[model samples]
Target: MKKTLFDKVWDAHVVNSIENGPQILYIDKHLIHEVTSPQAFQELEERNIPVLRPNQIIATADHNTPTQDQHLPVKDLLSRNQLQKLSENCEKNGITLYELGHKYNGIVHVIAPELGFTQPGITIVCGDSHTSTHGAFGSIAFGIGTSQVAQVFASQCLLLTKPKSLRVTVNGTLKKGVLPKDVILYIISKIGTNAGTGYFCEYAGTVFENMSMEGRMTVCNMSIEMGARGGMIAPDETTFEYIKGKEFAPKGTEFDKKVAYWKTLPSDEDATFDKEYFFDADQIEPMITYGTNPGMGIKISETIPTLDDASFEKSLNYMGFKAGESLLAKPINYVFIGSCTNSRIEDFRIAADFIKGKQKAENVTAWLVPGSKQVEAQIVDEGLQTIFEAAGFELRQPGCSACLAMNDDKIPQNEYCVSTSNRNFEGRQGQGARTILASPLIAAATAIEGKIPDITKYYLN
Candidate 1:
């Protein structure tokens, strides 16, 4: 029987099926971090259970770790306790951990792929919504709650109901300055945040085929924002190329064998999806969210929508934005270009190349954080650090900096920030903070202009 890519992977992972309940799906890789695993570890301790497969689990400290002064102890009391507990739990359970100040440490999602721990035709689970980022390599990866994290640690398996498959295809050439981030923001706007409920999305089309691995990861990382269970792009030559020579990836003949299997993981020609959506890549412009929700987005050149719905009105009020107003030239106080969603080397390269020899607006404070230490090293090697310094931007230590309000990187209340991170919900960056989510290019241009500008004019010309 012809099967969609999701079916091919999910079915392969199903160890057994209950009569009228969920499937017992085997997880090949289980990732944990500070925020969610503490409770799970405590639960295991109460039950007097040892981690059934310690080697299969990998822990990292990112969510609550400070982006600066990593060598010193965490200043926040709660953050310090969480990191300490995570280290203790991992040590007691015999699991590998990438602690703070460790060279390999980074956001769980970022480090997993960079280390080649995320592979095609496998099942990966993490207590992080952005775990979907690993699906860029054609794997079945998704987030789980604390209980589910405990379940995986105890048995290396999860109970899950099969999700319906949705195929989203984007064909044609993307216009200049229309990045993968713009493509996803455009999709969420058209489909609404709740449209993909109970569905796992398979991204297919010429546009996705031509996208780089980092671009694919960016698209999949935002799958949860649109209510999808997860999103995936089938493994191809580009996927294999990215995995090759990575620390955990298969080598020599083993790699060749793995590639042979991965090559067959794409959806068959006769496979059908439960739902399908097609987009014209040419129509997608550089997108930014004007309202609180990620779905409340518009093209950079478009005006805010004047909807009669109360929710729309509430969003505009929260954002201090008026209907029918253009975002262009709206003054911004902060510009953040980092996160699991857009802090990869490719993202920094785009921003650095654009900001070279240009100075940031005096009124704007810009933060350029790499996603991982490896990415930070790459930046230094490529001389992007020099360009950033020349442009009046400072490179911060790697972590989930400014993506959330967890640490000292929080944006001040009511201050508008052009950020490349995911989500623009009310107070997502800090209490009462206003977030304008955009691509790295848009963020960099906004920093240069101290407001949202026509990025095409600033960079392309």
Candidate 2:
């Protein structure tokens, strides 16, 4: 029988099927983080259960860790407590943990792929929504709630209903300055946030095929924002190359064997999808979200929508934006260029290279945080750090800084921030904070102008 890439990976993970309930799906890799696992660990303690597969479970502290002062003890009471508890939990359960200040420590999603823990034809789950990031490698990966985390720890399996498959294909060449982040923002805008409900998305066509593995991860990371169960791209030579040499990836003959299997994981020619959508990549521009939702986005050159819906009006009011207003030249108080979505080395390289000979606008306070310690090290080795420092940008330590209002790094109340992180919901960055979600290039350019600018102007001139 013909199967989509999602089906090929998901079916392989199904351990058993219930008569009329969710299937018992085996999780090949279970990732836990400080924020969600504490409650889950407490639940396991109450039940007197030990983690079933300690070796398969990887833990990290990122969400609540401070981006500065890695060598010093965390000063925030709640953040410190959570980090300490996570370390203790991992120690007690015999699970490996990349604690704060550790070399491999980073956002759970970022370090998983960097260490080669994410692979094709596997099932992965984390306690965070961006777990869908791993699906970029052609794996079946998704987020779970606290209870589901406990379930996975107890049995290394989950009960899940099979999701219908949706294929989204984008063909043609992207125009200059448009990035994978823009591609996803454009998708969400056209399809609305709920278009992929109850579906696992398969990204296809020339745009995805030509993208680097890092670019693919960026697209897949935003899958859940559109209400998709997850999103994946079929593994090809690019995927193989990215995983060829890493700490957890298969080596030697095993690698060859694994690649042989991965080659067959793409959707068969005769496979059918429950729904399909096609897009022209050339039409996508550097995108920005003007309203609270990811789907409330427009091209950088476009004006805000003047729709009559009540919800639309509320969104504009919350954002302090008016219908038909152009975002260009709007003053921005902060600029954040980091997150699990866009803090990889590739993202940093793009921003650093752009800002090399320029200085950040004096009116803008900018934060350039690497996603992981490994990425931080790479920045130094590649001399990107020097460029950043010379451009009046300071490189903060690795963590999920400014992406969420979890730790000390947060946007002040009522301030507008041009951010590369996903989501622009009210209070997503901080209480009363306004977020303008854009690609890293857009964020970098905004920092230079102290406001949102037509990015094409910078490229052209």
State the weakest 10-residue window (summed lDDT) of model 2.
452-461
Candidate 2 global lDDT: 0.93
Per-residue CA lDDT of model 1 for 76-168, tens digit only, reads 999999999999999998999999888889989889999999999999999989899999999998999999999998999998999999989
CA error at residue 9 for candidate 2, angstroms: 0.9
Alpha-carbon lDDT, every model: 0.92, 0.93
Per-residue lDDT of 32 in model 2: 93
Tell me how far the alpha carbon of residue 58 in candidate 2 is from the true structure, in angstroms, after superposition: 0.8
Residue 269 lDDT in model 1? 99
Model 2 spans > 4 angstroms off: none
Residue pairs that clash (backbone atoms under 3 angstroms), model 1: none
